[model samples]
Target: MMQLLIVDDEQIEREGMKFILQKSFPSLEVLEARNGKMAIEIAKTIKPDLILMDIKMPGISGLEALERIMEFSTDIKFIMVTAYDTFDYMRKAIKLGASDYLLKPSKAADIVETVGKVLKEIVVDKRSRAASKRQETVIQKTRSIIEADLVTQLLFEHVHEVNVDLLIDMLEIDRNHEVFVMNVLVPDSSDHPYPLIKEKVSELGNCLVGALSGNQLPIIVFRDKNVSFRFQATSFAKKIITVKQHHEALGWFIGIGNVYSELNQVKKSYQESLVAAMEYLSPAKYRFYAEIEIVEEDFFDLRLTTLKKDIVDQIKLGQWEAIRTEVLSLVQFFEQQGASLVYSQQRILEVLWVVSRVLNDLGIEAKSPLFAFQTIDYRQLRMETGQLLDLLKQKHIHYYQQLEADNVQQIKQYIQAHSHEEISLETLSVEMGLSPIYISKLFKEKMGINYIDFLTECRIEKAKKLMQDPRRSIKEIAIEVGYHEPNYFSKVFKKMVHVSPKEYQNAIHGK
Candidate 1:
């Protein structure tokens, strides 16, 4: 219920106004104050929705009380009640934020009309504020989804050219700013503390937290120009550790990757972070990519880097033989380098772990690559590593053998059918029971174009068909063909069709 307070020095005046208000607005909770001071106190206590103040009052004038009350409660509606109808008095009341003025000898109808107008305004203001708050909440949720999707695209899948840049802009991160990936390994038994970890990262204000995938939670931290990289990474790692310490049973490990200036290159950082976490025997809760004790000269060799990338690419392409050959070759290179047996095995395990991660990303569940026992000789190492590779190959083959032969056809059909809606690789991934990366690779290889390109083609073709209807507006056609913004729709149409949407529409109708 709305509350109104009447303030006047004369008790009869206050009582008369309250009686009239109570009779007109039976539901209104009417309050009374004999002076401006009392009016301020009542407003502060009861927080009334409206106030009626007499210009003439003891101790403090009506305008003075209006100013005092407004200082603390700007939402309260005010009406100045006075006998004087001078322009000066009206101006002063208006200047002091009075909602409406009530002449001292006003009729009951006039009193009710003025109070009702102010009350209606208060209700409208409340509704508008509520709507704005709801909009803000929706925007926050949409942003979180976009952030998660962006992280997935950058780390696990090919970035779609049509939306990745726009998404980066929407996320408001400077592309010039460097970024690094932090991978958190949460044990399977512990209740996933994703919300708590996200809350802690949000305090830093520049991190994008990805959805928890199995046991790994990835965070991309933007470099702060003022802070050293180590300081920022260390501080955040400690905060994550603090969250982990709360759950003693959960063995949480964090891996910090090397910093990269380009967003696209951050995938490499993600890979490094995974390798860093491979050292599960480390006493510390967190490990940095740079802290991996492998000899720097051998570790940073360009040939090794290229070979690792090849293994990742081959895994996505489902070329198990190629992947196996690459793994053994990598082992051979390490052997010829005269690296220690333990060090070589560790490096080989790291490479195998990368393979396991890539397979996991492709929606293929593979066990973490580990040798049965520490190898004491090069021959034993090769035999054990080969066996692990063969096991992984069988898992990959088994997963694909279960998939429908025409998965690509199904994806193409889905896009063609749903082109008029918001479609993304992530959406298709969910629908097809495949990872976005695997779907993207398959679509490109089989269809000879990116999935996003195919989706755009479908939308544009539909838009062309829609354009044939002379009755439809360009904006309506854009919306019907899945583009929300007419301007962007027109831009894409021009790029693909070699003419603007309007120009094409004009040509078709001879307008």
Candidate 2:
């Protein structure tokens, strides 16, 4: 029961989008705007949850209109649509907080996905707002809800332009005292999320506890000047175990973050605790953060996070050389980090997982029997991690080569089937889910010649075969080989075969 608005200068586009949305979402109320002016007016009245808009309008261009509209309401999500693929428009739209964008002639699936993603974000925002309102209602109970929300926010680093001092005060964290973060994830299939958590928070003395999203409950512990951090952290870890043993229904997975001297570093503690907690899900019920092979210094490299994305994109483009280069770069990075053999093995394992994930999305399975990744070899894993990952890429290259081979075959089949019809790179690209450049390059790489030359060769060859019957007219044969003009076909035929179509037909007919 949500509203969506479609804004484009073209009447046809606006109407088309409206129909598409209505078909996809039966309950949604779809509104249309013919121009930016109409779109701005509709926003003033309706303030729709999402918008599908074009960039180049007659006056007050789509980008300008979006910028003006955002001045009043920053919440509305916009998916910018344009026929042009200019980076400038994309950059400007992003700066204006566009939810996403669609190119001209976008499919129904793309439209639905872009809209669905924005709608999901809106729902999450609404939930966070509701959670905040609930916390606001009960200020007296500082230890439970409000404190938990703030701590959770800190751990998630959800604080963007937030009033840090006010947040610090609300959590009641001391600057001088050493702080630690411990979180427990319990598996509960029941309707209730955390029965024992709420019941046990009251018993913990001077602890700042909070409930994170999903089934996580984070406990913030403080060590005063008199108490040692080791003693306090050890006691907290044992307490979580004790809590689970007593309340047997809630099978607990506990993670205790490292100790820190300042409240600002609670996020570090949260990260450590989160890693431990994640490890515990498949590992042990209780683990200390230090046991994790990876350190914070290793986590700060933005390159590592974005490297997987690069791999996915290059793989999608069928750029095997680029993927190989990136895989080596990743492995080399781990080698330079000089982390433990376990870390290097784990790192390569993660790389394999990313590659498999990308391949799986494309309906391609990456089966690695040698490196099952279920177990690891200590010595071979560290020194030969790069070569191991490099070797595994044969499957990826093989998949792409097969795909390209199949694609070339498909193009050939399509040309053969549609000998009489017009065929262009644009049409073939649409069919193959590849760009024109890629299609062109693949044709030469596979067939050892240009696409146009191959097409002409195919047409002339078919024309020669048809000329055997002698019952079909010259014009008919020309039309059958995708040529509108007989003279043009003759010119092309003579250039390639050293004989005109008429001469060839007459010679074969023994004229």
Candidate 3:
């Protein structure tokens, strides 16, 4: 309910104004303060929406009380009341932020008009603030969804050319900065610790925490120049571990990857983080990829670069025969180099792991590639590696066999139909029963655009149509096209259409 406070030294004046306000504004709660001193006290405690102060009062003057209240409560509206209509008193009241003024013997209609005007302003201001708060909430939620999808794109799937840059722009992160990946492996299914972990990570520094995919949670940490990489990564990992330490039974593990200057190479860092996470037997709960005792010297040979690319491409293409050829050829090259069978097996295991992860990105949940037993000789090594490849290939084949050819089109239609509602990759993943990573990959490969871009296109197109009607406001058009905040809608529209919504509307009307 609205509250109004009447401050006058005369008991008769306070009572008269209270009765007048109560009769006209039946809903307003009237408060009484006999003097400026009492008025200050009541204003502080009650925080009335409006105050009618008699200009002259005992002890503290009305102007003094208004000034004191103004210091603490700027939102409270004030009106000056006095028998004198002198310029000095009127000027003083105006200087003190009084909204309106009244003569001591004013008519009942005049009193109601002035009080009702300020009351209307208070109501309008309250509604505007509430609307702004709701818009902020919606924008925050949209940013989170975009951040999660960006993490998935960078780490788990191939980056969409059109969407990646736009997503980074929307996230307001530096694209050229170095970044590393961290994999937090939750041992169980409970998601209770995810929010705690994300909150702690945010407090530490800038990072993007992804949604939980199975038990694995990925985070992309931008490099902070103020601290050494080791110190930063170690501190971040330890803090994440502390989140679950109280539970004791959670058994969470963390893996920190090496920092890379390029975003595309971030996937390599993510892969390294997964490899580091596999050091579950280590004494420490967290491990860095560089700290792992893996033989990467031979694995980094320039000769293998082209072959590695070929293997990745072939895996995505599901060219099993070509993939097998590349694997055997890599092993043969290692043998010709006089590399030991153990080293060859290690390198081949790395390749197979990459294949498994790539298949995982394609919606095939292949088991982590591992040899059943150590190969004693090169012959046994080749045989075991072939068996592993065959297993992965069969899973890949089964996945494709069951996937509908029109799945991408169906997803496209769902987005087009629901462009006027909140849509996120996670939501589509749930509805289609596909991993978000796979959905992203499918958009890039089949549609030549990411789903985010497609969704934006749908929204902008709808907004353009709505703009054709001169009767509709930009904010109304924004809501009709799925954006909750008009400013955010304008930004997206401007980014996609090369003009602000107002400019577009003006152009349409020949303004």
Local accuracy by lDDT, each model:
0.81, 0.70, 0.80
User: Which parts of model 2 are misplaced by more than 4 Å?
Assistant: 1-290, 293-303, 306-339, 347-379, 417-436, 461-471, 484-511
- For every model shown, the clashing-pair count is 0, 1, 0
- Arrange candidates, best lDDT first: 1, 3, 2
Model 1 ranges with Cα > 4 A deviation: 1-137, 245-251, 261-265, 294-322, 340-346, 357-362, 367-387, 404-511
Task: Write the number of the candidate with greater lDDT, choosing between 1 and 3.
Answer: 1
Candidate 1 per-residue C-alpha lDDT over 1-511 given as tens digits, one digit per residue, 9 for 90 to 100: 5689998888888888888888766557898898889999998999998999888777998888999999999888899888865547767889878889988788987997788777767755654555577856655675677688778878875555534654575566677779999998776554658878988888887888888876688999999879899999999998887787666644477889999998879998998897776655457888898987675454545655676678667876778888778778867877887887766776787777667777886799975665545578888988999999888888888887656447988998999999998888899989999999989888887778999899999999999998898889999999988999999999999999999998999999998
Best by TM-score: 1
On lDDT, the leading prediction is 1
**Structural similarity to truth (TM-score) of each candidate:** 0.47, 0.41, 0.43
TM accuracy, model 2: 0.41
- Model 3 agreement with the true structure over 1-511: per-residue lDDT tens digits: 5689988888898888888888766557899888888888887888998999888887998888999999999989998987764547878889889988998699998998788777767655554555577856655565567678889878754555545655665566777789999988775634467778878887886888888775678999989889999999989998898887644544477888999996667888997887677654346788888976554465545535665567667876878888888788878877887886655775677677677767776678865665655578888888888999999998887777556447887898899999998888999999888999989988888778998899999999998998899999999999888989999999998999999999999999999
